[model samples]
Target: MFVQNIRNICVVGAGQMGHQIGMLCALGGYETVIVDVNEDALKKADTLLQSIMEKWVTKGKISEDAKDAAFSRLQFKTDLEDAATNADLVIEAVVEKLDVKRELFAKLDKITPSHAILVSNSSTIVNSLIADVTNRADKVCNMHFFYPPLVMDCVEVVMSDKTSDETAQTTMNVCKQIGRTGVLLRKEISGFIANRILGALQREAVHLYESGIADYKDIDVICRKALNHPIGPFELMDLSGIDVGYFVMQQRYAETGDPQDKPAACIEEKVKAGHLGRKTGKGFYDYAKEGVKN
Candidate 1:
């Protein structure tokens, strides 16, 4: 279905990306329902949405009336079936795991209406594999949005072999309606475009850190000033969360079999210790102190 035809959109997952994505859709005037199995995660998503909207209001980027309208457009649910049953589109934004995502897709396929579009917001997983669980593969595709979906305009519209041209076109129209720039990829790839660039940088940064050439923060400074990049690799990595980075990189490395794709040994160690960046208050760098910690 096209944007004008689309009414209720169900977003599965209430984590960081999921919440932001749902908020963006609601702001665009879609009836949005964000679902998560975890009650705490659902509550957190609601709180995060409020915080983001409040920040925009404070910056005069959005009016109080706009914020009220956006909030009214959004809803939250803990049940999967309730969210998917009547949705015009169901977008899965849950954790990045093959089996977990596959299972959810299978469940959503069973519960969602036959015409409902099923999409994934995966950064590195193969779009085709994610479409495998559903019988309506023609309506299954990738709608990869960048970090902070509200601020970012670019969204990668990925089409797998089973993805229908109609579905792809409709998704593009939906992106336009939401005020996002949509780029099409004909085939499924591990990291798509943006993540592929990020993957390359991640591999090199890990290699640099592992080789004892420089500390994490030192490397971050060089990238920021010398390259005029907005955020240094190490600092960005920490903010992205070490566990999430390690998860994506490990899968990409395994898929590509590229030695450069492998994360540094320190990453595994840190993740094992639960130092998962800003959320944990510690990662490659200590967010609390605003610097790297060995």
Candidate 2:
């Protein structure tokens, strides 16, 4: 019902999560535009998306005709205003910074149609902090899509007190349209649901590794073999990017000023060394040897 009104979606950012999200929207039959300032990044996103679609075709997950139709509905643009002017929904996938999001929301509030909804794909930064910058606070909420949105099936739809019921319901409808499960949080929280649980597990894992209780690989093995988990915490960090976790920690610490919320030493070190997981070909484990790309 709510989904019927959202015909066009503007995804701001063409990086990892942004590109995949744009693809999902396009496949859902929404006219989707992904905007990025860097032309090189847009080109890379196009190439990667095409490769992923081809893999889906080969896997029989989607027909070649379906892939072609999805690509036809998707567009890449450098100008934000041009991309968002007619957008019925805008999902921001930019950097995990408060100021950046606030500024972007402010601009989007002015550029988009009055009825458009503005959502953030931030993992930790809550929408409450960003919504106040826009006049349509009732339409601003968090639609947190996990990393690699093409594969992940769950999206957290978080709402602040100011968010209207219509806004939250519409977002959930959008999720269903894209063939993903949507979990709605009536109250807003910094990390929402999944990441809060994941953060605790990761913190303990990092503590065990730093304490020399067990090697990171050994811990990961125990998690996979004994606990029946799909991947170890360290491996997940590498796949998601160590710098992303580092930034999430930084945001949490800034909000709470708690020492425990600061990034783990190993994460900070890895980020500083530019060893940000599969994207950099290194993180907790070396991916260069395996020729893996995230």
Candidate 3:
């Protein structure tokens, strides 16, 4: 019933997660509008999404006709008000800054219809922090999707104390409709589930690298070859953007004032240099070369 109510979906921020997530919703038969403040970002998202859909079609993951239908259902815009005014569900996939999200949520509350459910794609910060800025806290929740939403199957559906059951169930239903698995978290927690575990592993990996025990490349090789993990921590970081992890650490440290939660020196260096992983073409490993090695 809740799922049936969501027909027009608006995805805010056209960045790494937003574009692909909008594609998922469109593919799920929802009328999806992906909005971004920057025109260039929206243009880039359009090109990238087309390339992704083409790859999917070539790989037999989706048919060419299905791709055309998904694109037909998807639209891109630079104006938030125009994109979200009639939306039944709005997914905020902007930067990981708390103040930025709080401001956006407040604006969305005013722009969207009363029944619209607003969900954040934040990987670390819980929706509880952002929900308070809006009048309809009950309608705000976290729908955290992994990097490259088109590929990742799992989404963390986290609810704040004020979130209604209908909102959560509706989000989960949307996940199923988009062909992704949604794990519901009854309560809000920083980093949700996957990131909490991944954070711990990343912290240790950074520690091992900083401690001069081994090179980051060597550590990645060991994790992949020995532990049988598909991708190592460092490689995953590179793929997901080093600045993203840095921002998450900064947010965590600000929340807890934990010295341990501060961004590692290596991450800080990379972020400062603007080498923010796959998007920027240089991160833990340089992707400019033939093999994408450091």
TM-score for each candidate, following the candidate numbering: 0.95, 0.98, 0.97
Top lDDT model: 2
Kindly indicate the candidate among 2 and 3 with the higher lDDT. Answer: 2
lDDT of each: 0.85, 0.95, 0.93
Mark the regions of model 3 whose C-alpha exceeds 4 Å error after superposition.
Answer: 291-294
lDDT of 3 by residue, 1-294 (tens): 389999999999998899989999999999999999999999989999998889899999999999999999999999999999999999999999999999999999999999999999999999999999898989999999987898899999999899999999999999999999999999878888999999999999999999999999999999999999899999999988898899999999999998989999999999999988877888888788654421
lDDT tens per residue, model 1, 165-278: 988988888888778999999888888989889877867877888889988788888889898999988777776678877888787777879876776788889989998877
Model 1 poorest 10 in a row by lDDT = 285-294
Q: Give the local distance difference test score of model 1.
A: 0.85
Question: Number of clashes in every candidate structure?
Answer: 0, 0, 0
Model 3, C-alpha of 128: deviation from truth (Å): 0.8
Off by over 4 Å in 1: 289-294
Q: On residues 152-228, what C-alpha lDDT tens digit does candidate 2 reach at each position?
A: 99999999999999999999999999999999999988899999999999999999999999999999999999999
